[model samples]
Target: MATARKYNVEAVFKGAPKKSDFKIVEETLPAIKDGEFLAEAIWLSVDPYMRLFVNSSNVGNTMFGEQVAKVIESKNENFKVGDYVAGMFGWRTKTISNGDQVRKLDRSVYTDDKLSTGLGILGMPGATAYIAFLSICAPKEGETLVVTGAAGVVGSAVGQIAKIKGCRVVGFAGSDEKVQYLKSLGFDEAINYKTMTSLKETLEKTCPKGIDMFFDNVGGEFYDTIIPQMNTSGRVAVVGCISQYNLENPEKGPRLNPSILAKELTIKGFVIYNHLPRWPEAFKAIGEWIEKGQLKYNETVTEGFDNMFDAFSGLFTGKNTGKAVVKA
Candidate 1:
């Protein structure tokens, strides 16, 4: 028998999530069945999507998330004991899984010290940046690409990949530190939106040729400002609306349909789960980029499982520079 400690949603979020919204519980696990494995979490991911998902989630359900865990005991032949795996096992210190949606971590790609990346640049965020940006934006050399929330796990990756594609990259982040981080990633222009006197004016000056492709993460005023400045036939990948995720009610924005129609913009919103089959393709490409020194990644890791809520809530406050993960 094993025991697991996990976080359960205690209340639905209002403006932003609070510690009182979750409660930690310990459960004694039953013995592993014929094809089950017991795993202890090594790293847990706290992402913006968790906040959005909580809106529709039932109270008392385990807080939704993904984690990298080690197989401590196994009855399944496919999953050996001591194997590391990444799975949607929630914010739990331990999990008993039958391997339905679990993937054994590729040792060749993730070494012992780098295993935490299984939740970051080499994992879901990497896949999202590679697959969604490439397929949706279809970036071309010499084109200008604008990324909002540009210092986040996915956004930072998107900027670098665009640079690798020879696109002129302009990125928007919240703080001066993040702007510098974006510049370090080789963004042609990094704007601190919080300090900009006029976002429209700064964007117009920075992207003189007009934005050719827009990878939007923060959707609100930034999205509104970028839409009217796009070149004709500009492509927009609506990856995330992080700005609106914490709102108790949806904030209305200026209607951009006129700008979209005038420019004949192509806009598509995507959820990464729909592209699951192509994840390996993304991982392979991103892994190679990392190996070649063409891509770099950072993680803002919180040290303890008890601090999961703090890490999760930090996404809205610009507290993380790259991927935000918790060591369990």
Candidate 2:
């Protein structure tokens, strides 16, 4: 028998999530059946999507998330004992699986010290940035690209990839620190939206050529403001609406239909899951970039599983500059 500790939903989220919304519970696990394996979580990911998804989750369901785990015991031939794997194992200390929705980690891609990258740049966020930006935006050399939420895991990757493609990049972030971080990543201009006296004016000055492509992670007024500033035939990838996720009621904003139509903008919303078949393509290219020193990433790691809620809540406050993960 094995004992597992997990976080369960205690109440549906209202506005931003509170620690009281989750409760930790412990349970004993049965012996592994044939074809099943048991794993211990090493790193757990806390993403913005969890806040949005929690509203629809039932009370008492384990908090849903992805993790990098090490198989401690196994009856499955494909997953040997001591194998490292990444999967949607929720926010649990341990998991038992028959290998569905699990992928063994490629040691060649990341060494043990860097296994946490599986939850960050070398993993889902990385793939999302690579595939969505390249495929949807179809960036061209000398094009000007703007990335909102530009210091985040996906956004930073998007900006760097755009740079690699010879696009001049302007990034918008919440703090001066993040602005500097975006600059360090080679953004041509980094605006701290909170400190800016006028976003519209700053955008116009920095992006004098008008935005040819927009990677929008923060939706709401930012999206409204940026859409009208795009060049003709611009492309917009609506990857997240994190700005609206915590609101009690959706914030109202000016309609942009005229700008969209007049500019002939191609706006599309995407769920990373929808592009599953192309994940390998993204990972392969991103890995090569990392090896060639064309890409860099950072992670804001919280030390304990008990602090998962804190790490998650921090996302709204601009506390993390890159990926936010919990070390178990």
Question: What is candidate 2's lDDT per residue for 147-232, written digit by digit as tens?
Answer: 99999999999999999999999999999899999999899999999989987999899999999999999998889999999999
What alpha-carbon RMSD in Å does predicted model 2 have with respect to the real structure?
0.8
Q: After superposition, how far is residue 250 of candidate 2 from its true place, in Å?
A: 0.9
* Runs of candidate 2 exceeding 4 Å displacement: none
Clashing residue pairs for model 1: none
In order, candidate lDDTs are 0.93, 0.93
Q: Put down candidate 1 lDDT per residue, 193-304, tens digits, no spaces.
A: 8889998899889999999999999999988888999999999999999999987788888889999999999999989999999999999888899899999999999999
For model 2 the TM-score comes to 0.99
Instruction: Estimate the TM-score for candidate 1.
Output: 0.99
- How many clashing residue pairs, candidate 1? 0
- What candidate 1 gets wrong by more than 4 Å, as runs, is none
Candidate topping lDDT? 1
